[model samples]
Every structure is written in structure tokens, then in C-alpha cells.
Target: MEPTTLRAVMAALRKPETGCPWDLKQDHQSLARYLREEAAEVLEALAALRPGDPATEAHLCEELGDLWLQVAFHAQLAADRGAWDIHDVERAIVQKLVRRHPHVFAEVDVEGADEVLTNWAAIKREEKGQAADHEPRLLDGIPASLSPMDEALEIGRRCAKVGFEWPDLEGVLDKVKEEVGELQAESDPVRVEEEFGDVLFSLMQWARKKGVDPDAALRRQMIRFKGRFASVEDDARAAGGWEQRDLDQMEEAWQAAKRKGKA
Candidate 1:
């Protein structure tokens, strides 16, 4: 009687005769939301982590395990259908890593991280049967699951690699201003939406050129806003309720919080 491992536990949970009803009923499509949710929880846990804090470390570990469960569950479902299993998934990634990292696994020499990345892309293209002489598709290798901001950043990077980009940060900033002007001038709802998207895309390019991660910047801003807003909420509660507070009072509270270094 050995202790059951994660794979074995997943298999038991999906067993037809004795498995939990909810576990037995799940399929890949139905489990997709959980996969996304678990990944988001892992990100939140990572954001909450503090140096030398065991509680935060434990929280991150738990969230990561929840994310891993989604992978194991999917593998179990595939195994039940006689397609593949967890080991197949693990082995495929291991093989791909070794195949891609020629600098470590083979005799290929790279001077720096940039050269390593360039070599990795070349190797990846070769593996995908993209011939060296063939004109590569602009967005062929970008993952479809990337967020729109991330996708825009990748698109900008790919285009820049082939000398199809603004020459300087000022050029990108000018493009951003142009896009904003177009967005502000649009009146029709459909056209406004399109123009707004263009503005966001241009801003993403600007962020890329500025060496800023838009997602991380947004997350940090939101965290600051949350803390400031919590101060406003406390003020509202002290004054009776939200109904008793006005926008100016809320602004004062927010400014106080900002002065207190919440921002």
C-alpha cells in the first residue's frame, strides 16, 4: 500500500464506478474555466508574496497546486479516451525544451541572452518547417490565447525585428497621439470602438518601445487604487454610510491615503 500520487489521485477521481460525481462528469470543455481561474489565482498569490514570509509562500504553493490539478485532470481525461496521459504531456515539453536549447544541449554557442533568444527563434522556425528563404508570416508564431495587449506587444516586436518600426521613442509617442486624436474624433459607436482599439494598440507599442510591461503597470496601479479606495470606504463608514459621503469627501479621503503613501 503505497501513498497515492497526484496522477493516481486524479485517476481515482475520474473512475466511472467509484469516482466523485462532479469529477466524473467533467470534460475538457467544461473544465476550461477552472483552468483559467486557477491560473489567475496563482498570479494573485504571486503578487501577494512577501520576502521571508512563510504564509505568503504557502499561499503561492497552494495556488500553484490548484493550477497543476487542472493539467492533471485534463491528462486523465485524455488517458480515459485512450489518447495520451500525463507522462506524455510531461515528456513532450521536456523533449521540446531540449530540442530548443541548443546552446545547452548541443554545440551551438550564444554570446548573450539576445543571441540565445535569436537562436531559439531560428531553431523554432526550423522545427516548424519555416524555411530560411521563405518569407515568414508576420504573426504566425504568436499564440492565439495571449491577451490583446500581449498580442499587440508581440506583433510590434515581430514587425520591429524586420525593420518595420518607428525609429525612436518619439515616433511611437507621436503615433500614440495620432491614434488618440482619431479616437476622440470618432462619433459613430462602431467606428469609435475601432478607433479606441487602435489607440490601445498604439499605446501597447509605445509601452513596448519604452521597455515597460503594460500588464504589470496596470496591476500595480490597480493595487494602489484598491488601497486608496479602501481608505475612502473607511471614511464613508465613519461618517454614517456611503449615502452620507459625497464625491469631494471621497476625493479628500483618497488624497489623504495617497499622501500617506498608499499610492
Candidate 2:
């Protein structure tokens, strides 16, 4: 977020007579979806970044600016509603960084990176609420609307922190197999849906054990799927065969595109 460009954007949005009608119409609830979409786009752009790829790097930089616009827009809205301003937000962030990272800012007992992380988690738990003994249940902090796979991984992580977890990936893999069998045995759509969810949860657990981000991996595959499908569409158009295309033909193109996509 360039300070001058950000200031101009804020000013434009807040301008009484000339402000954007759409921007003026949006409330927090309506803008939330855009925030999520923009964030996902920024993540996708970052993933595209590579060494010596100036064009991709430039795209990432541009997408980051777009991502920042969403943040600044939300900050402006909050300021307008008397909740908080961007300056207060920055101040709070700086204050928290100084407060939590006592290793750098003050004398705190941190022997290693792991200890520092443990200290940060300890501080966060204390800030959340002092129920150190009871253990905030594995599912406590995650939002319901979080992607189900990510939600499961977070639940697994929190539970693992409190000793309520499998000792190894084999256990999670076994659960995945069990969930798959349950999915196979189901006839009812509702039961199938339930079993499918269990499968996703179990796989997320395995991903957690493997130290892989299920959300990010899924996003990467989704991007590949989108790109391959677009290529397949172009292939069809190039062949002058649009309406006549069926699943078999699409599948052929999909297989070709996927091979290239993976490469």
C-alpha cells in the first residue's frame, strides 16, 4: 500500500458528492465476500511468483496493492463508524509486536525458535481468557464459515497441542481409510455427505501430521483445475467443435491439459 495512492483512494471513497455509489452502498457484511475473494486472488498471485519471473513478480505486486485496498477500505469504514482508525490499527499492531516478542524488545527467556513460538502461544492464550487448565476446546476459536478442510486441520492442530490427538500419521491415515469405507457404504445423500465430511477431516488430520497446509494445497490444485479447464475450452474452440463436445472429448482435452499443467 503506497501511502500517497492509499490516501487518494480513501479520499475518493469519502468524497461526499463524488464518492463511488457502490462503495457508499456497501456495509461490512456485503464487503466481507470481496475481502475474501481479493485475499484468495492475492494468495494465488503470490504462489505464481518465481525467481527471475519479472512479469509474474509485477503481477504479484499489483495484486498485493489490490489486497491492500480491501484492508484500507475496511479500515476507513471502521473509522467512519467510530470503531477504529488505520493509525490505531498500526499502533495496536506495533504495541502487540513489542509486547509479545519480548526476546527482541525486552529480556524474556527464549532459548530457541520453538521456545519463542511456545511463548507467543502462551501469551495469546492468556490474552484470549485465562482457562489454562480447562483447555479451550479444539474447535473453540475457528469460525464456522472457514473452509471445512481448513477448519478440520485447525481443530486437529488445537487438539494436538492439548494431547488429544493421534501419535502419528498412521493413525490419521487409518481414520481416512475408515472414513472412505463409511463413504462407500452410504446410500442416502445425507449419509454420504456426512461420510464425505469425515473423509475430508481425516485427510486434513493426515495433512497436519505431514506439516502440509490443506487449504493452500487445495487452492493450488483448484488454480490448476481452472487453468486446465480454460485451456480445454480453448482447445475445443480451436477445433471448431463447441456444441458437439461431450464428456469424452472434454476428458481427452482435460487429460492433455492436466499433463501440461502438471509439467
Candidate 3:
């Protein structure tokens, strides 16, 4: 469907007297989870897409439509509240992109992507009123809503940009080890929790330095675990029941599953 058609459809659903009762009742807070779900579905669709596949392209297009619907829904909600509309959202992003990309839109020169990113960050700081500060925070604007692993990655990247990172990958690994040792030595639960978080944070930084996405890595591991565990359960069901299996038996089943390339 065309963009204008979709916007009209959403507007009809949001009509006061003749609209969907559920859609009419939804506020931004209530619709928040749908937005997150749609975004994740888009990611899943992209990850499942194979290069040069027309079917994958259709799947991605459908997923993107769902994601875009969330944006339109939010825009409608804001418009109903007299805050802003879809056009305002579109206009703001257009203005922000043109303002931020001096090298592309204006006379500024940049050598490569790194320089472009540096200039972009500087422009962002200026826009946020932090450029003139003497002692600006490294982790400013890192969203609290992000998962701990992602937040750690963002914090590490921000700090690294300001030369506050470890001397080498080995130094980061050593910090992880040191954090683990402190965690082992701690007897207090609160201190142990803090130290445990430090260990994960250090490992997250190490992963970032090594050009790995910690969130995606962990997600893949979890998927592997699911496959391997399902194989183990299949074996147990074939024998008798999972409750009848000892730890050694389960380990054997797990190893057999791994050997079968389930993981």
C-alpha cells in the first residue's frame, strides 16, 4: 500500500466514534511493548534473510511494514494529544540528518568513516549542549532501557573514544580475570553482586574490543543451548523419562547431541 493510504487507514482506526475500541484506548505507554516486539521481529526477519533471495526480500518487506506501523501508530497518538504528527517526525529527522552530515551536505571534508563518526559525535555533543563543558561524561546519553550487555558495550565504546580504555586486549582480559577473582573473594552478597556485574562488564568490553557483538553472541549461544537440550530431551524420552536420568547420563546425552551437530 502507499504511504498516504496507510496513514489514512491508521487515522480511521483512531477515529473517535467509528474507530477500534482497543486502538482508541491505547496510550503511548500501553503501545510501547508492541513497538519493541515489532522492532525485534524486524531484526529476526533480517537475520533469517539469505542474500540474493527474493522470498527473503518479501519477508523483510513485510517485517519492515510492521515496524513502520509502530512508528505511524505512535505518531497518531502524539497527534491526538496535540504534541506532534507524522509530518513533524519526518521533518525533524530530515533536518537532523542534513544538519549532522556536513561532509555530505555542505563544504566540510572528511577522510574516512572514522573521521565522519568523530565529527558526528562532536556535532551531537554541540546539539546536546555538552561541547563546551570542561569535564564531560564519557557515557552520556547511554539509554537506561538497554540491556546490561548492550549498555556495557556502549559505555566501553564511549570511554574508548576518549582514550580511557585499556592499553591492550590483554589488559581488558586481565581486568576480567581480576574482577572474577574479587567476586570469588567476596563474602557479602551485595558486594558479590557488584563484583559479578563488574566481571560481566569487563567481558563485554573485551568482546567489543575484539569486534564481537556481545548481545548477538550470547543470543546465538542460547539458541545452541536450546537445540542441544532438545536433543538431550529427545534421548531421555526415548529411553524412559528425563527424571530417571542421572547427571552422568544427561552429560552423555548432551555430548551425543553435540556430536550430532545439534549445537
Candidate number with greatest lDDT = 1
Show the lowest summed lDDT stretch of 10 residues, model 1: 43-52
Cα error of candidate 3 at position 249, Å? 2.4
**By lDDT: ranked, best first:** 1, 3, 2
Model 3 lDDT tens row, 49-154: 6678999789989999999999999999888889999999999999999999999999999999878889988898788777456536666667888877778888
Candidate whose TM-score is highest: 1
Full-model lDDT for every candidate: 0.89, 0.82, 0.86
Better of 1 and 2 by TM-score: 1
Per-candidate TM-scores read 0.87, 0.80, 0.84
For residues 172-229, what per-residue lDDT tens digits would candidate 2 score against the true structure? 8998999999999999999999999889888888998998877667777887888999
**Which clashing pairs does model 1 show?**
none
In terms of TM-score, how similar is model 2 to the real structure?
A: 0.80
By the lDDT metric, which is better: model 1 or model 3? 1
In angstroms, what RMSD does candidate 3 have relative to the true structure?
3.1
Question: How many backbone clashes can be found in candidate 3?
Answer: 0
Model 1 gets an lDDT of: 0.89
Count of clashes, each model: 0, 0, 0
